[model samples]
Target chain A: MPEMTYAQAIDHALGQAMAEDPRIVVFGEDVVMLRRELYVRFGPRRVRQTPISEAAFLAMGVGAAMAGLRPVVEIMMVDFIAVAFDALLNQATKIRAFSGGKWNVPLVVRTSCGGGYGDGGQHEQCLWGLISSMPGVSVAVPSNPQDAASLMISCLQSEDPVVFMEHKLLSDYWRDYLGGGSRKTVAFDVPENGRIGKVEIPVKPFPPGKGKVVRKGEDLTMFSLGVGVHRCLEAAERLEEKGIQAEVVDLRWASPLDRELITSSAERTGRVLVVDEDYSAYGLSGEIAAVLAENGLRPAFGRLGTEGVIPYDVRREAKVLPNAARIEQAALTLASV
Target chain B: MRMSAETVPVEELYRQMCRAREFEMALARLWEKGLISGEMHLGIGEEAVAAGVVAHLREGDAICLDHRSTPPLVARGVDLEALVLEMLGDPEGLCCGWGGHMHLFSREHLACSSGIVGSSAPLGLGFALASQYLETGGVAVAFFGEGAMNQGMLLESLNLAAAWRLPLVLVCKDNRWAITTRSRTVTAGNLARRARSLGVPARRVDGTRVDRVWRAARWAVERARRGRGPSFLLAHCPRREGHFLGDPMLRVYRDPLGQVLEIAPPLLRSLLARPLSRLASRVRCLGQIGATLGALGLELLLEADPLERSGRLLEPSMRARVEEEARREVEEKVMRAMERRVSRA
Candidate 1:
């Protein structure tokens, strides 16, 4: 087992998937060079470089799928998806159904997303929310390396189009954390059998559609996802000294919510505090609160929505997004009020 | 009038033109009777180009169709009844009533007919990319009107297809008119020359004659399939009908009514004024147009069987099936979205 960061974990997963399927292609702006140098062992065809035409390239991937090839087309930045939305939402996603199920578009589209990066508004927008709203698309935002690899492999194997969103910050920061603290750092490790390594399991799947308890507490249930989950966990750890036993839960899947798990947890804890980085209204937290209200868990929704009309300026964004301090305050408030 | 698998004859080309004209007339009738909805752009005099280009294509090759490509899709083996029913908004239509006439799709024939004006250009390039990636001996063709040359998507596609050396054929069916604007009035320079500037082999074909179009298209298709990269063909045809039914051509063009009136004199008087050569030319043109329409009528009769029968075309059971499919698709989309949100969150 080994301890690896989230980014390193993603690299490991990408390497593993590439090694498994020759049909799987990794392509984007600097992907051909970066992916090859990172993997060093793979050919230039499987890992290709492309000119900056996102729509056309994405369409090329779609066309490639119709002719029986699995492709992983990367949009270097998620913001570029705006230029290729037509191909992504119309051509690739609708090919199978449009053709009466004659062909499946088995392709993976990867992009780096989120607002923590100093790249400012254009580069750091977490637009997965908009993509998630589209049909015939599978969107994955892996916070850790284990998920990055597993989810990517699953996407590569699936017969549908998947939008894999990798957080640039995590890729740059979390390689060792994904290693699971292993003595030997092999090229990559799959979590199976005796191959278990030394990585902290911050949270695991407790119940479907429900948040998992990172810590058992009689006080408040702090619900969050993505980086918010990490922040909430940090807050829970700090609050342990104040004797405010905070039970932090990671709301993994956002769309086909594990409604049962969330509601049951809320009912068990009686008091609920939802946290998120996206804005307040219509965000995941609001949806969760609505779901709870409809299902009998009237928990307090303490959403620490980022404060900004626009998403430019990294310093301002940092001040806006839900951080450890905000999470701790929200948790304390839920526990007391 | 010679014909082969690789080439269409003049007489056959005439027949295709007639078919396009009659089919549009029939479609207009359907629309008037409230049997069809949405909008349609007819390809009447452009029949020679559609038949010519498509004749050179094989089973494995794919063609991207614009809004004005009904006859090509039909000739390529799309079911006429399904096409008609789709226009009628029936659930059993090609897109299960999701796409109307302009968005006809036939998987069995590998034809993708779309409504978006310049969308096919990129998709066709995609097919070329697919062919190159898979090492398949197949070519992808794009049938765009002259007006579409201005679209950024098509222009970009040209560069990409050439850069990748993809096996693509870009057929610019310059049917003289894009809606109301004549190609001469809107486009700059020559179509083939524009393609040549992009490093693609370009050719000009007499789109009024089927055999001429067929020969040029065949050569381009073969060249592409053999990995010679992309080709562009400018097919110069004409527009006999208005952009759509009820859209009188007189308003768009200068004095179409006056020209029709001028030509409405006694046949004998005109013949006497022109002598034997002039009379012969007039007779031949009229005969060609008539023969074309007759052939179209026959083809429709033969091809329109499935959509005609009252007991089967849109049976209650069929409607139910379509509903079930739509519901299934919607639910699947919703569930998948939910799943992604859950897992990603």
Candidate 2:
């Protein structure tokens, strides 16, 4: 067992995968901060730098993947993915199906996302929902370091295109970078857990299409992903103080959602609360609600999420985003209902 | 591979161009018959450029094409029947009927085309980037219109290719019109200068002439194969069918007098509004109509079809035979494509 930050884990997994496979090549703007060690180690050919052209670079990743090269392309920010959306949605995702399975884009688009950092509306979006909604491609959103590394490895090894979303709050370096007005310090598996603070890498993969119930409970089921997983745990702790017995489940992947786990969990509790860091409308929250409805579970449902915008002011952002307090309050309402 | 470029077989290149032209002609017939859905874009006049450059391609070479992709795809030896079936929205077609003419792709040939105007550059650069890593010693060539050069991705691709020294040949078929708008008016600065600024060697050639396009493409592809980075080729050609099938402008090309009569009433109505006071304005308005006709005249003046132009390079008897063979081949493809099938594309 080893301890590493979420970003460090991404680096470790990508490095390991690249070491195992020479076909893998990394490219992005300045090779992305999360993959600095990769640039130093893999050098120019493997870990390449690019001009700030999201469309070209992203499509290049698609082309490379088609030509038998595993390319991990960093689009810099999840918001920046809009610039590369055409490449991702039209080219990367549809290449395999369009070419009659003759061409598969084994690409990993690593983009940093999520809000509560006060970077304003443009930069602070967690729009994995838009990507996940697309027919082809898999989206992996890791909640902790171990999952980040494990999922990163899986994304690299996938025979198809995958988008690896790195939440800003989950990254250790990003936390230090945006430390100015960040009120809530989210420490998910840190100094408190002696095992998590170790230098060795943990490659224990929970695997894709599986959700992990971090804190098991019986009263109510709380669904979350990315930074919201930590928020859900915090809310669960407070819910426990009031004897609510809220279960916290970390949904690591956005697309190809763990419907089996989600439906089973909802079936057990018969009540669900979806707390998401992204906007609730057509988001992961709505998706979970739809999944539940499709599976014939119409329990006491409640969802807490951003109102489609991440404000520039830190206080306003924290207030807008799904925090532990909001999650707890939402849970209380759902429990009462 | 270089020998393919050096010899410049006139009859062989002519046959390729003829095959592309006849294929598009058959596609046009299908479109006219209301078989193909959506906007039909034919690379009717760009046969020489496609045949010229595609002639130099080896087994490992890749191609990325723009909306009017039939020329390159035909030159690349993609199944003509499959192409026709794909256009007809048949399951046993290229791309399994998922992609139309513009978005056609073939993994076997390492060829792809997109309806997105400027996407060819990025997609082609991706192939070039892979070839660099694969060490296949193969070069990638992208065929796009001059209009696509304005797109951010194409510009970025040029910079990336030049900076990384990826084996890429950016072939810009400068039809001089971006859809309906004259390219020179909207297109800022010189195109060759734009490529030169990006550290790429650029050359402009007569796109109607296969010999010229062949030489230019051969030189550029060789430069890329040598690991010297990307090269830009501006092949100035004509779009025989303007922009797309069923373009309103096509009506203007056919029965110009009727079109003028259909069009002149609006201008004539303005003249009748104020007979004397708005005289100067009326003259200026007439000048506008005259300019449109002048543009049409300009289009007619450059009416040298690439297939016909290249065919003349061969002996008259041999050229006639080649043209007949190409026509028969395309006819057989159209017949096969029309027959129902439940097999893979």
Candidate 3:
């Protein structure tokens, strides 16, 4: 097994897919810098760079997808999606349903989201809620390198649009994007050399929302997304020390959530706590509550997320974003033990 | 300028324009019968632009159209029956009832349409980018309205196409109206100049003349095929039936007396109840109605409809024959679509 950083896993996935498929093209602002080897391997046309035109390039990806080319576009920052949302919310999401399946938009949008290195509100955001609310988009938030690699492969093979979100803290490129070091401790351990992490969750193609229980217990279930899953794991370990057992489920795929996994997990423990970095208002936590309620599950439920606007100060950002202590506290409150 | 009729055969173009015209007229009739729901946009006037550009498209060429998409789709030889069924929301239709007339897709022709304005340019860029990378030797043509040229994405597409040297042709059918607003009132500068500034060779043509549009489209399409980047063409046509099939102002044109009687009483009442300072504005409203009615009357006096202009290019007897054939084909498709609906029901 090859050890991998989250970014290397993504690069490996791109190289593997492009090796097998001639239709894959990667492009965005400074994407060549991140996937430099891909640029060397796939040549300029396949790994092209574009002007700072998010809306046009994204829409072009949609058109390219319809033209039978699978374009994996990078959107520099998830905050930049604001300028290109018409492409995402309307064109990319509506084309399949509008074309009545006559067209399959195999467009994968790779973007970096999450905050820890003091990139303000504009630079850091987990807008999965905005996209997951739509009908025809699949969102994959990989918490570890292996999950990122597997999810990238699944997204590339999907017949529709998939949004692959990488947390800035975990992506290998973060070390170079700014002077910040890669948060290897924030993710699960990868093998020593080849960049493959230990977490191996099979991602169902397209609308993948399967949850992987990284740590199992019988007391209470804690669900989280992306980097927050690691926080949940740390919290679960602490909870175990205090004689409180916690099951940690990493909700890898955001949209079309695995209802069966969520319901059964909640039913088994009779208690549910959703910990995430996305804003709590109309976000992932709220969505999980709705899903559980829709499934008729009446468990003791608690949720924690960014309190409000993410600040520029590192300490204040930490206060707003979830940490292991907050997760443990939220879990203990829910456990009432 | 040399007449395309002198240099080329245009009976085929005339026929193409006729089919597009007739096909849309049939769609308008269907909308009138309430068989198709939602706001129906009919490409009743821009037949020349569609026929002219589509005539140059060959195997592997791709197209993306605006909301008024039937003209190009008809010219491209897409299954008319499938379009009709799709418009009628039949599951067996082209898009299985998911895509309505505004959101049509034809896999066989590699054609697509979107309700979003200015989308065709980006789509064309994408398709052309694919053609460039795959070496498919296919040219991607985008059909949009002049209103779309104002959008940032279209300009961005122009810039990208130039930078990438993608094989793309951008055709803007200038109907002089963005929905109900006059295009020039909201638009600034020249459209062709803007494209040219972005390094795209652009031309403006009289869109009602199929031969003129045909020649312009030929030059642009050829340039694209030669890998000379994109060309922007502005075809000044008219939305002969107005913005959509049932345009509110279209009623004012169709039934002036009835519309004035229905609207004026309230308008006059509000005017009298309002401050005298608003008298000029109130009177301008009535004048605008009269202007719309007068414009309709004026349009009837002129041979401005593209289909009629193109039909004149062929011999009268040949013109009649082509029109009859197109009419019969549209009727057959309409009947087939109806039968599909009945069987499904």
Whose lDDT is greatest here?
3
CAPRI band for model 1: incorrect
Our tally of clashes for model 1 stands at: 37
For candidate 3, the lDDT comes to 0.78
Query: Per-residue lDDT for A1-337 in model 2, tens only?
Result: 7666677677777766776788989987645223434543455567665644577789999898889999989876787687678998888889888989887889899988876544456567788887899989889988877778888887877888899998776675554343221123222222222113333453545577788898999889999888788888888999999999989888889978999999999999989999877788888888898999999999899888888555443445668888888888988888988
Full-model lDDT for every candidate: 0.62, 0.77, 0.78
Better of 2 and 3 by lDDT: 3
| Candidate 2 segments whose C-alpha is farther than 4 A from its true place | A1-337, B1-6, B255-286, B341-345
Instruction: Summarize candidate 2's per-residue lDDT along B1-345 as a digit string, tens digits.
Output: 335534778888899998998899888777666555445678999999999999999999999998899989998999998888777666667866556666788999999886566778988899999999999999999999987887787998999999999999999998876654466645679999999999988999999999888888889988989998899999988888867765544556665776667556644543443223435644554564456546856785767877767777788999999989998999988887787643332
Question: Following a full C-alpha superposition, what root-mean-square deviation does model 2 have from the true structure?
Answer: 21.6
My TM-score estimates for the predictions, one after another, are 0.45, 0.52, 0.53
Chain A of candidate 3 compared with the true chain A, TM-score: 0.92
Question: Per-residue lDDT for A214-264 in model 3, tens only?
Answer: 889889999988888888888999999999999999889888688888999
Model 1, range B55-162, lDDT digits (tens) per residue?
777877898998787878755656555666555545555656545666667777778866555678899988888888888788999998886776567787888888
Q: How big is the positional error of residue B254 in model 1, measured in Å on the Cα after superposition?
A: 70
In order, the first chain's TM-score in every candidate is 0.80, 0.93, 0.92
